[model samples]
Every structure is written in C-alpha cells, then in structure tokens.
Target: MFKSILAAFDGSEGSEAALSKAAELAILCGAELTVLTMYRHHSVLEGSMYVTNADQPDDVDAIMSNHAKATAERGAALARQAGCEKIRAFVKGGPTARTIVGFAKEHDNDLIVMGSRGLGSIEGYLLGSVSHKVTSLAQCPVLLV
Candidate 1:
C-alpha cells in the first residue's frame, strides 16, 4: 500500500484523470494525498530570452501559478471527496520534472501520478512530454495518466 501519494496536475483532462486515480488509491490505502503544480519565473525580455517568455506587465506568472495552485487545491478536494483523510496542495517554482521529482523524493512519496502531456513547448518547459521525463528520472514509482 502506498503511504504517501503525489499527484501532478496542470488543469488538463489527463491530469484530472490522474488526480481522480490518486484520490481513489489514497482512499483505499488510507494514504496521504498531495497535489503538486510546478511553475516558472520568466526572465526579462532581453538577454538571450525569448520575448514571448519575458515577464509580462500583468503578472502572467502569478496568474499561471494561481491556476496551477487552484488545480492542486481541486485535486485535494477530490481526495477529500473520495474519503482521503490526509490531503495537501503544493505549488513550486522551477522546472516541472525536476520540481515534481524532487518533491516526491523529499516527501517520501510511494507513488507519483501525472498527466501524459501538457500545454506545448512555447508555453513552458514541462508543457509537453514532461511526464515521460519525470517517470524516467523520479526515484519512486510513477504512473503516467
């Protein structure tokens, strides 16, 4: 039985599936459920950085972080709805695969679940196929949804 379970979400349908699955597992095992969302802080427009990734005037990073955090919160809610007793929401800033793997390892999670894919390359580093990399690099067992 998984004692500590981590679920990664990015507001996608696949991520929703992963969250639901994790919730079910948590309920079954009476395991702790944690939801993780990784965010990035875009650099300035100049100095080898793409204009699209530049820091926007309207706090786009904040909005994205909020969205991701909300996704995690919703996952926690689902865990509660599924009768999970220990539920948590986590949001971190950095590369997705690294942040997620690090979080899982640091928290000693027995299971890691995430969506199969994400937004796109232009949007973020972990937007596409990041789940595959996390599965390859993570120390614990990873279930790609």
Candidate 2:
C-alpha cells in the first residue's frame, strides 16, 4: 500500500483524471497525498517580453506564481472532496518532469500518480511528455493515467 502519494496536476482533463485516481488510492490506503503544480521559471528575457503588454500587471512573475498556487490549491480541494483527509498542495517553478521527480524523491513519496498528458505545449510532443520523462527518471513507482 502507498504511504505517500504525489500527484502532478496541471488543470488539464488528463491531470484531473490522475488527481481523482490518486485521491481514491490515498483514501483507500490511508496515505498522505500531495498535489503538485509546476510552472515555468521565466528568464530575464521572457520577463522582459511581458513588460510591453499594456494590460499586464507590473510584476508578471508574481501573477504567474499566484496562478500556479491557485491551481495547486484547486487540485488539493478536489482531493479533499474525493474523501482524502490528509492532503497538501505545492507549487514550484522549474522544468516540469525534473521538478516532479525531484519533489517525489525529496518528499520520500512511495508512489507518483500523474496524467499521461498535461497542458503542455507543442514542444512537449517534439521532446516528450512530462509524465514520460518522470516515469523514466523517478526512483519510485510511477502510475500514469
């Protein structure tokens, strides 16, 4: 039985499915659950690009960071509604696959449950899905939904 379960959620349909499954498993096993949302770490150049937008706020990075936090909170709420009592949510900015795997290891998670596909860009298809990379890189068991 899983003791610590981590779910990678990106607010996509696939991620929703994965989150649901993770919640169910956590409730069944009486395990701790964590919902993780990964956002892009904007570079100086990328941050500068947002400065020209008339409607965008002064601190674009802060806005994006807050959005990531909100997404993670939503995922956690969904898990709680699904009957998972022990659940936490986190948001980080980095390479998605690497971040997920690293968090799982750092948190000593027993299992990783994530979507087969997330709200990835076209580059994901060109390179690989985050789930694919996490599965290859994680030391613990990975379950893709």
Q: In terms of lDDT, which candidate is strongest? A: 2
**Local distance difference test, per candidate?**
0.79, 0.90
Clashing pairs in 2: none
Which digits, one per residue and each the tens of the lDDT, describe model 1 over residues 29-144? 88988988777765544323443334543555666677778877877777688777898899998888888999999999999988777653644344346887797899899987
Q: What TM-score, computed on C-alpha atoms, does each candidate reach? A: 0.81, 0.91
lDDT of 2 by residue, 46-137 (tens): 88777445665666667788889999999999998998999999998888899999999999999999888788876666434788899899
The reply for model 2, stretches above 4 Å from the true place, is: 51-56, 123-128
